[model samples]
Structures are given as structure tokens and as C-alpha cells.
Target: DKKVVLITGCSSGIGLSLAVRLASDPNKTFKVYATMRNLAKKERLLESVKGLHKDTLDILQMDVTDRQSILDARDRVVEKRVDILVCNAGVGLMGPLELQSLDTMRQILEVNLFGTIQTIQAFLPEMKAQGQGRILVTGSTGGLHGLPFNEVYCASKFAIEGACESLAVLLQHFNIHVSLIECGPVNTDFLVNLQKVELGDTSLEQLDTHTLGLYEKYLQHCDSVFQNAAQDTEDIVKVFLDAIQSPSPLFRYFTSGVVPPLTQLKITQPDGSQCIRSMSKIIFSSEEK
Candidate 1:
């Protein structure tokens, strides 16, 4: 039987790539329900899939922040059971914390933390009854360690880590696996889609000059990192495939293969000060170390 998989945020990036890969599987191993918040944006997903994968793929409209939409998507599943659930829908918010409004911060949490939890909540009962399932969440390095201007974004991802870890402990008893695919910068539209306070914007006019200087440096650092280190979405999908195929999948899979050096520092240096200093040097220092 083809494993029934439902993935959120299939409009683009890792989610789109994963959906395309699974739907195009030569062995026909998976039946994919690739969902996005806006079906209007599905043309890109469809275009990427190219040739017909009629039997293996279905596109559904699902707004992760809306409980009714999640439930509606679940109800539309012809198989009535999701063997694998991928909660990959999330957004990013960047800028100094002081510039962030309550509504903007709430929007980030709504989609990144609460949306993920809600998606899992909708599917948990059925998975429990089935006595076997896989839950894969798209996590971030920001979650493991903080970033300079991504305070709200990091908060949301960190919350997801907590939620997933708590669920993993209990779900193991039900033969269900919860895995977090921790990603670093990836070649995606995330930079374009994120809510950012740009330099010279009217909003920045009232902000302090020191903060403004740092923000400019952060932006440069961000561009350099993406140009030099961002992985393709295909690379991320491979890690997801490994997790899905494993009989005993690990709780966390780093897309870069091992914990990044900076992220590792957090574990080795529990004091937290060292990690902060290192990150500050990397982003704020005029010269890259």
C-alpha cells in the first residue's frame, strides 16, 4: 500500500520540493496530499511536478493558522488516514525586537508555533488509532541558537522544538515517530517572504543610529551567507526521505548532516555567554572571522 502523506506549505521551497519528489517516486511508494495556504500559487508546484503524477499527488488548500481549514483539509483526505504528516508551513519575521509590533510578532507565532501544533493536533487521534505514523516538522538553526535580528522568528521556531520534543516522548509508545528536520539557510523565497524592516524606511527614521548600523551589517552578512552556504531544497528533501524510510527515525535530523559548530557550542558551553559572543562576532563584526 502506498503510504498516505499530507504535507503543509507546498506552495514552495522544501515543502514543494518534497511533494514533487514523493509524487514522482519511481517505485510509487507514496500518495501525497500537498497543501498550501493559497491554491492560486500552486502553479509553481504543478509546473515543477511537470509530467502527470495523477495517482500519487493531490493539491489541497489549507491555511495552517485556521483551525477550520486544517480540519477541512483533513476531512478531504480520501484515504481518511495520514500515515505520514509533515508540518512544514511557517513564516519569518526579522528586524530589531523594538521595531516589531504585537500583531506582527503574533502573526509569526500563529503560523510557526501554533500552526504546527494545530496541524499535529488534527491528525494525532487517527495516527494513534492506526498505531503507527510519522510526523516530520521543518525546524531551523534559529531554533537551536538565536540570531541577531530574528528574535520573533527564533522564538517561534524554539517553541516548536519544545512542542515536538514533548510529543515525541509520548508518541513513541504508539509506534509513532516525531522528527524535526533542522535546516540552516536554504535557497528559498523565505528572504522575500519574510517581514523585514529595511534600511532608510520611514519606520527606521525614529530608531537609534547604532541599531541602524548593526542592521545594515546584518543584512550584508545575511546576503553573504545565502550566496555562499544556502542548500537547495532538493538536499532538504533527501533528509526527509531518510527519516520517512527509517524504521526508527531519529528525533532530529540536521540537513547539513551534523550539528553546526555554533549550534554545537550551545551543548558544550552551557553558560550561554560563549555562544552569544560567537554569534555577535559573526554578524556584527565588520570583518568576517
Candidate 2:
């Protein structure tokens, strides 16, 4: 019996990569429902899976922020039985917090935090009743560390970190395993989508010079990380495969060498002040030199 695996955010990047990877499995281990916010953007996904494993994959329309879309998507899945649920949908918000509007911030939380919760709520009951299932979320090092301009993004991921950790314990009783795939930079458009300071925006014009300077430096820092050390999508799919296939998978899996040390600082230094200062130097200090 093939596992019915449903993944969100399949329009591009990791979600798309993972979906195609599993769907093309020669053994036919997975019946993949690759979902995204809009069906129109699915052309890329369609192109990737062409002539290969076409029967195993289905691209469905689902907006994580919309509960009805999620419910409708679930209803469309076979038996409504999602043996593995990958909450890969996320949005990025970067830039000076002051420059961001309340509406935009709410949208981030709605998609990244509340959206995840709502998706799980819709499918969790069925998983519980079935007595066994797997839930893998695309967590980030940002969830554990506070980055310079990614305050809201980090907060939303941090909330998910806590939620997944807490739920892992409760779900253990039901033979349902939960894993958070904590990764560093991956070769994806996600970084490209991070907030860029608009030259004509009046809001950014009001920020202090130092804040603006830091924002510029932070963007450079992030770009450097992505350019120099970002892993390919194939690299991350390997970790996902392990988490899904292993007889006993860990609660957290780190996908890149670059992210481990970033997460360790907080653990090694209890106060977390050292961790913050260290990161501050990485993003802000290099500009001095």
C-alpha cells in the first residue's frame, strides 16, 4: 500500500522538489498531492514532472491561509487519508520592523504560523484515528536564532518550533511521528522573495541612518550566505527522505553544515546575549571592515 503524502507550497522550491522526487519514486511508495495557493502558477511543476511518474502526482490548488481551500483540498485526496503531511508553505518578511505595516506582519503570521496550525487541525483528526502517520515541517535555523531584520519571520518560525515540539510529545502516544526539518540556506527563490527596501517608500525614509545601514548590511550578509553555502534542492530532499523512511526518525533534522553552529550558540551560552552579539557581528561588524 502506497502512502498518501500531501505537501503544501508546491508551486516552487523545496516543496516542488520534494513532490517531484517522491512522486517519481520507481517503487511507487507515495501518492503525492502537491498543493499550492494558485493553480495558475503550477506550470513549472507541470514541466518538471513531464513524462515521468505522471500517475503518481497530482497538483492541487490550496491556499494555506484559507481554511476552506485546505478543507476542500483534503476532501479531494483519496480516502482523505494523508499518511504523511509536509507543512512546507511559508512566507518571508525581512527589513526594518518599523517599515513593515501591521497588515503585512499579520499576513506573515497568518501564512507561516496560523496557516500551519490550521492545516494540521484539518488533517490531524484523521491521522489520529488511523493510529500512525508522519508530520514533517520545514523549520529553519531562524526558528531557533533571532536574525537581524528577520524579526517577524523568526517569530513566526519560532512559534512553529514551539508548537511542533509540544505536539511531538502528545502525538507520540498515537504512533504519529513529528519531525522539523531545520535547514540553512537552500538554492530556492525564497531568499529572492525576502523584503527589499524600496527606494521610493516613504516609510523607510523615516528610519534612522544606523537602522538603514544595518538593513543593507544584513541583505548583503544573507546574499553571501545563500551564494556561498546554499544547498541544492536535491540535498534537502535526501534529508526529507530519511525522515520519512527511517524506522525511528528524530524530532529535528538539520540539512546543511552552515546552520548547525548558528543554532548551537544559544545552547552553549545560556544567556543568549553572546549568541545575539555573535550574530550581530556577523551581519553588522563585517561592514566595518
Candidate 3:
């Protein structure tokens, strides 16, 4: 019996890599449903897989933000049951909070928070009845700790942490496991895909000079971190595989293999001031602490 897996956001990044990897599994261990909001973008996924493994791979249209689309994709699942569900569809928003439009913020929450929950809601009943299942969420360090310009993005990820943790407590009773794969920067199109306030954008013209300076610094820091530290999507997929294969999978798997030094501050210093200072130093080191 091949494990039936459905992954959201298969147009690129971790989702595409995971889909290709699972479908190409030498043992043919998984039947993968690699879904995306736009099937038009599936050529990259198809190209990556080289048009092989028809039996192991299926593509479907799933716009996580749309309830009907999620249900429609679920109905198309030939197996009628998803043994593994990967909610990897998400977008990022960056800039000073004051400059972020309400609509843009709502869009982030729609896809990152509500969409993930909706997808899980659609599949929960069937998985519960099956007596076993795995739910893997692609989390972020931003969720676990604050970043300079990613307030809303972090909030959405943090919300998922709470949601998944709460569900884990109940799902254990059903022999289902819920895991969050907390990722740091990954070599993906996320930077390109995110909604960002660019330096040259006209909107920045009205912002205070101090904020403009900080935003520039933040962008530089972002580029440096991703250039030096971002992991490949393949690395992230391996952690997903670990969670899927483990008999007793952990509730949270850090792709870096251990807790990050900065993130550990949130745990070690509950007052939060210390963590705030540390993060500030990392991103705005040019300015005085």
C-alpha cells in the first residue's frame, strides 16, 4: 500500500522539490498529489521530474485561499484519503508595519494562516476515520522569533504553531501525528515571491527618513543571511522525510538540526527584551544599540 501524500504550493520551492523527490523514490513508496494555485506554473515541477513516474505523481489545482478549490482538489484525490498532508503554500510580506496596506496584510493571513487551516479542515475527518495520518506544516524561524520587518508574516506563522500544537494534543488520540518543519532561510523564490516595499517605490516617498534608513539596512541584512545561510529545498525535504518515517515523530523539527542560538533566546529569556536587543543587533548593527 503506497502512502498517499498531498502537498500544496507545488509550483516551486520546497513543495516542488519534495514532490519530485517523493515521486522519484526508488521504492515507489509514495503516491504524490502535487497541487498548486495555478496549474499553469506546473511546467517547472514537470521539468524537474523529467516527465517520469506517472503512477507516483499527480497534479491538481488548489488555491489554498479558496475553500471550493481545496475541496475540489480533495475530491479529485483518487485514493480518497490523504495519508500525509503538507501545507507548504505561503507568501511573505515585508516592510514597516505602518506602510503595509490592510489589504496586503489580509492577503498574507488569507494564504498563510487561514488557508492552511482550511486545507486541514477539509482533510481532518477522513484522516481521523483512517486511524492514522501525518500533517506537516512548513513553519519559519520568523514564527518562533520576531524579525525586523516581518511582523505579519511572523504572526501568521506563530498562529500556525499554536494551531498545530493544539491539534497535536487531540490528534495523538487518533493515531495521527502533527509536525511543524521550522525552516530558516531556504534557497527558494520566496524573496522574489514576497510582497515587499522596494526602496525606489513611490510609497516610500512619504515615509520618515529614519524608517527608510532602517528598511534599507534590513534588506541588506536579509540578502546577507540568505546568501550565507539559506538551505536548499532538498535539505528541507529530508527533514519532512524524517518526520514521515519516524515511528514517533517529534512535534517540531528544526531543519538546522538543533535550536538556533537566537531563537533559543525566546525560550531562555522570557522577558523578551534580550531577544529584541539581539535581533536588533543582528539586523541593524550599523545603528547604535
TM-score of each: 0.98, 0.96, 0.99
- Backbone clashes in model 2: 0
lDDT of 2 by residue, 1-289 (tens): 8899999999989999999999999899899999999899998988888857767998899999999999999999975799999999998888888888888889999999999999999999999999999999999888989887888999999999999999999999999999999878889889666655554567878999988877877877888998998999999999999999998889999897345775787788878888878887888886543
Ranked by TM-score, the better of candidates 2 and 3 is 3
Better by TM-score, candidate 3 or 1: 3
Model 3 scores worst on lDDT over the 10 consecutive residues at: 280-289
Root-mean-square deviation of every model: 1.3, 1.6, 0.7
Pairs clashing in candidate 3? none
Candidate 3 per-residue lDDT over residues 1-289, each given as its tens digit: 9999999999999999999999999999999999999999999999999998899999999999999999999999999999999999999999989899999999999999999999999999999999999999999988899887899999999999999999999999999999999999999999999999988899988899998999999999999999999999999999999999999999999999999888898899989988999889888987955
How many Å off is the CA of 226 in candidate 3?
A: 1.0
| TM-score for candidate 3 | 0.99
Q: What are the per-residue Cα lDDT tens digits for candidate 1 across 11-51? A: 98999999999999999999999999999999999999895
Pairs with steric clashes in candidate 1: none
Q: Per-residue lDDT for 5 in model 3?
A: 98
Model 2 residue runs over 4 Å out of place are 257-259, 286-289
Which sequence of candidate numbers ranks them by lDDT, best first? 3, 1, 2
